[model samples]
Target: MAFTLNVNGTDMEVDAAPETPLLWALRDHLRLTGTKFGCGIAQCGACTVDIDGVATRSCQFPVEAAEGVKITTIEGLGAEGEHVLQKVWTEMNVPQCGYCQSGMVMAAAALLKDIPEPSDADIDLYVDNICRCGTYPRVRQAIHRAAELLKA
Candidate 1:
């Protein structure tokens, strides 16, 4: 099936099966590789993307369901080194292997949008993405720092 997806503020056409996961469509068809494929079951959060402002697991989200929704991958977050989260992630050294950072950033972006000043508990509750390097503390710190930067 040919699906038209609004990705990163651009309308992209991809030919994929209706049940094909949006992760593959974005990476294979649209060539938006920022959204990674961690766990195909949507448990890892490595394929997180923003669909209409909500952080969604793209690995299991069907491409047919993604049509007409505004999708934002890590590539769409901002220009290189411009997004507050990106800067904070770098400044705070948020990633160890960097494999899960994109999804973590996407999840964090959604949380910050909904809660500008997130508490530790809120961070724990919201950004559920897993990092094998156990960078949760730094991720939280970077999120707080990003919030501060956004506030300034």
Candidate 2:
């Protein structure tokens, strides 16, 4: 079947089964490689994306469910790569191996949207994506830094 998804505010048609994971449609068909695949199951959170501004796991989500839905990947997180969170992430050195950074950033972006000034507790509750490189400390730091950047 052909699923037309509104990704990053662009409409693109992809041919895939309804059961095909949204991750595959985004990466394989749409060639949006920023969304990574860790474990096929949703536990790893490496295939995170924003569905209507909410951080969603693309690996477990079906392509059909994404039809006409607004989606955003790490590549489109910032227009022209100027997102303050990305800058904060780089300044804080949040990534070790860089494999899970995209997902972490995506989740953090959603969190910041909901809570402009997130507390440690808010981060602890919302930013639950696993980072195998153990960059939680830096991730937390970058989140706070991003919040600070927004305040300025």
Candidate 3:
């Protein structure tokens, strides 16, 4: 099947099976490797991306389902690598293995987009994406830092 995906403010036509996971389509078909694949299932947020500005697990999402939706991966989040979240992540040194950072950043970006100043409890509740490196505290710190940067 062929479908046109609106990703990162660009339209890309892909030829793939309807049931192909968006992760594969993005990485294999579209050659967007920034979205990592930690777990093929949705349990891991490594493959997270923004579908119409909503953080979504691309691994579980079918490529055909992404048609016409605006998908934003880590590559699209910043212009010239200046996104507040990216800057905060660098400042906070949030990643340990660096595998989950893309998804973590995407989730944090979405959270900050809605709640400019999210509390610790809010982050705990919403940012359920796991990081095996035990970087939760650093992640929280980065989120707060990004929020502050966004405010300034």
- RMSD (Å) per prediction: 0.7, 1.0, 1.0
Winning candidate number (TM-score): 1
Residue 28's C-alpha lDDT in candidate 3? Answer: 97
lDDT per residue as tens, model 1, 1-152: 89999999999998999999999999999888888999899999999999999999999999999999999999999758689999999988889999999999999999999999999998988799989999999999999999998999
- lDDT ranking from best to worst? 1, 2, 3
Stretches of candidate 3 exceeding 4 Å from the true structure: none
Top candidate when judged by lDDT against the true structure: 1
- lDDT per residue for candidate 2 within 46-114, as digits (tens), equals 999999989999999999999867999998998555788888887777889999888889999999999
Q: Write down the TM-score of every candidate.
A: 0.98, 0.96, 0.96
- After superposition, the stretches of candidate 2 with alpha carbons farther than 4 Å from their true spots are none
lDDT of 2: 0.90
Clashing pairs for model 1 are none
Residue 20 deviation, candidate 1, in Å? 0.3
